[model samples]
Target: MKKQELIHLHGLLAEVCNHYEELSGATVAHEEYSELGIRPTSIHKSKTDHKAAVFALADGITNEMTEETKEPVSAAAD
Candidate 1:
């Protein structure tokens, strides 16, 4: 993806993290992403930096969700 597209995706994921936290009253621990100091608006940063931030952010969000969902539902439908 182009740099602009990647940045856009990063912004969207950030929004998701924020929304999830607000709705769940829980925090998404994105320490890796925070350490990178690369916000979606950080256009000055390199594409690589934004890419890494996106991965870290996504991983954090998914990890939190996985912890919350311990039981798996059956795939069968009645």
Candidate 2:
């Protein structure tokens, strides 16, 4: 896939991750921990990991794009 596509995916992933994180935090602030439904801690951990991975991938893609698009420096500018 192209860098632009990867960048788009990365942004979408980040947005999802952010939403999950916010939900997790909000859940934890409540005074009740009902024994029904999914656990907030687990969701938080999962979202944190996913966000980190997405950032790493985005960084790698950025590096690759830069390397592939480097321009030669003009000696006259030196």
Candidate 3:
């Protein structure tokens, strides 16, 4: 994906984190992401930096979700 597209994805993921926090009333454990010190609006940063931030942010969000979702779901499709 182009840098612009990567940046867009970064922004989208950030928004998802925010929305999830608001809905669940629990902050995501984004220590890794925070340590990176990058933001979606940091357009001056390189694409690689944004990419790393995206991954870290995604990991944080998924970690939170995984902790909350302990039940296994059926794999059979309807």
Candidate 4:
């Protein structure tokens, strides 16, 4: 992915983590790392996993959309 895309994904992951914390009453400690000026390794891993899952979901949606369009590849090539 491009740098912009990766940044966007990171933002999305942060949003997801915030939502998760809100829903489950779980503390996402990583969100507060900046205040302490120390980054936690687990936070990066968590963000990466979240971004990957989001990408996979997007891929699924794209595949579904393509199938639903009913445009044959051969016909489109003509």
Candidate 5:
């Protein structure tokens, strides 16, 4: 693919990552502030693990496209 195409794809992927991040943040916030005290209703933690993976991938592509190679850590110690 051409550089232009790569840039476009990177932008699209960034958009996807941003939206997913919003959803994930909202889920966490709702759980935190609400009085329901309900546990995760879905396989959300597992799913969020993949969200970070996907964001890292998109960031990698964007970095490559922009020559901005940043190393982001995605691990959490439990």
Candidate 6:
């Protein structure tokens, strides 16, 4: 895929992962850096690992956001 395609795919994957994590109330863990962001090189790793890591981070952010919002989580829709 072209660079732009890859970037777009990465974003879509992240959004899906975030939605999953928000609905499931699960914590997703991945690598993080204090000063610099995730290494650009790592972003292009073998598809499996790269995708997994991206999703995991998205999940983590989603979970955190949900918790901070203080909204009650329910399995059944009201």
Predicted structure with the largest TM-score when compared to the true one: 3
lDDT of 3 by residue, 1-78 (tens): 888999999999999999999999989999999999999999999999999999999999999998988797789999
Off by over 4 Å in 5: 26-56, 59-78
Per-residue lDDT of candidate 2, residues 24-63 (tens digit) = 4531221121222223233433444444455554454445
TM-score-best of 4 and 6: 6
Poorest 10 consecutive residues of model 4 by lDDT? 31-40
**Per-model TM values vs. the true structure:** 0.91, 0.35, 0.92, 0.39, 0.35, 0.42
| Clash pairs (backbone) in predicted model 4 | none
Candidate 2 off by > 4 Å: 1-45, 72-78
In lDDT terms, how accurate is model 5?
Answer: 0.42
Name every residue pair that clashes in candidate 6. none
Worst 10 residues of 3 by lDDT: 65-74
Q: For residues 1-78, what per-residue lDDT tens digits would candidate 1 score against the true structure?
A: 999999999999999999999999999989999999999999989999999999999999999998888798689997
Question: Which structure is stronger by lDDT: 1 or 4?
Answer: 1
Candidate 6, position 66, lDDT? 70
- Higher-TM-score candidate among 1 and 5? 1
TM-score of 6: 0.42
- Please give the lDDT score at residue 69 for candidate 2: 51
lDDT of each: 0.95, 0.44, 0.95, 0.49, 0.42, 0.56
Alpha-carbon RMSD to native, per candidate: 1.8, 16.1, 1.1, 11.8, 16.4, 7.6
Q: Which stretches of candidate 6 lie over 4 Å from their true place?
A: 32-78
What's the distance in Å from true for residue 17, model 3? Answer: 0.3
Residue-level error in angstroms, candidate 1, position 78: 8.2
Per-residue lDDT of 1-78 in model 5, one digit per residue for the tens? Answer: 543444444456546545755764521222221332212232333444434443455554444434432565568877
Give the runs in model 4 whose Cα sits over 4 Å from its true position: 31-78
